[model samples]
Target: MIEIKDLHKSYKMGSNELHVLKGINFNVAEGELVAIMGSSGSGKSTLLNILGMLDEADAGSYTLDGIPIKNLNEKIAARYRNKFLGFIFQSFNLIGYKSALDNVAMPLYYQGVKRAERTEKAMHYLEKVGLANWSDHLPNELSGGQKQRVAIARALASEPKVLLADEPTGALDTKTSYEVMDLIQGINDEGKTILIVTHERDIANMTKRIVNLKDGIIIDDSKVEQVKASANV
Candidate 1:
């Protein structure tokens, strides 16, 4: 479903180029759940941003569901991103004044969905995340876990082909983190491709495969997890 070859990304840092990604070759098949794990400054997040089309790759061949995206103009990239992918971030990225339902509906609003239709569709996703009752509550009224659930709901409400989660369980207690992971696994089982970037080894092992990065390079990838299911948390 996704393919990236010989990808390179660099940023200017005080006259020295910070070469974040050095020839990353990535591939994700449909219905697969993959976790990207790496240390700080290892370029995991940079890779995620490039995969999400939020950041430009200095050089690469990238295709999503058969459409080449390596050199798309910003406008075309944004259109493809909104239509084909969803993003959930570490920060929960919800509007403070909006209710959970409204926040989930926001993406559809930008996509030109009618107000009533968007609300109803957003509610379905909210319920899927087990937050239907909290639909009317604002972000401040929810726990960190609930806020993240709302973020996931918002991401899923767009009905994109893939979900990109960056540090998805980073800002939660142990219990809440596992809850979120279970929720994400459920979503993955329903056939949406999931790509997650996380620093936690435990969380990475919860997915179908775990890939490790170092110095902007993939050092390891495993289809069989070293972590047992009983210790998913």
Candidate 2:
């Protein structure tokens, strides 16, 4: 569903340049749950940003769901991003003043989904994440897990083809993280393609494949026997 070849990225810092990704080639198939694991400064975040189309690569080719992603104008990029990608972040990125339902509905709102239909779709996703009863609660009122669940629901509400989660369980306790991974695993079982950028080995093990990044390059990429996060939860 996704393919990238000979990708390279760099950032300039005054007179020096930091090369973040070096000739990276990667692919993710439909309905696959994959984890990109790396330590600090390992370029995983850069890779994720490129994959999400939040940032353009300095050089390389990226194709998503058969569409080549290159030199997209901002307007067209935003349109494709909304149509094909859903993002979950470590921070849970919810508006403080918005209720859970409103937070989940925000993406759809921007997509020009009508009020009633967006509300209905958001509520369905909230319930899918087991947060229907907490729809009216504010982010501050919910636990960290609940807030992340709301974020996941918000991501899902877009019904995008690919789900990109960066450090999805990074801010939660062990049990809570496992529970969230369990929810994520369940979602993948239903045919959604998901990619997780994580630094935690255990978190990566929960996925079907692990892509290890070091020194701005993939050192290992292999499928493994999946570890069910629910067992740990």
lDDT of each: 0.90, 0.95
lDDT for residue 159 in candidate 1, whole number 0-100: 92
For residues 8-119, what per-residue lDDT tens digits would candidate 1 score against the true structure? 9899999899988999898999999999999999999898888888888888888899988877789888889889999999999999999999999998998999999999
Model 2 CA deviation exceeding 4 Å by range: none
Candidate 1 TM-score versus the reference = 0.95
**Highest lDDT against the true fold, candidate:** 2
- Model 1 worst lDDT window (10 residues): 224-233
Which 10 successive residues of model 2 have the least lDDT summed? Answer: 198-207
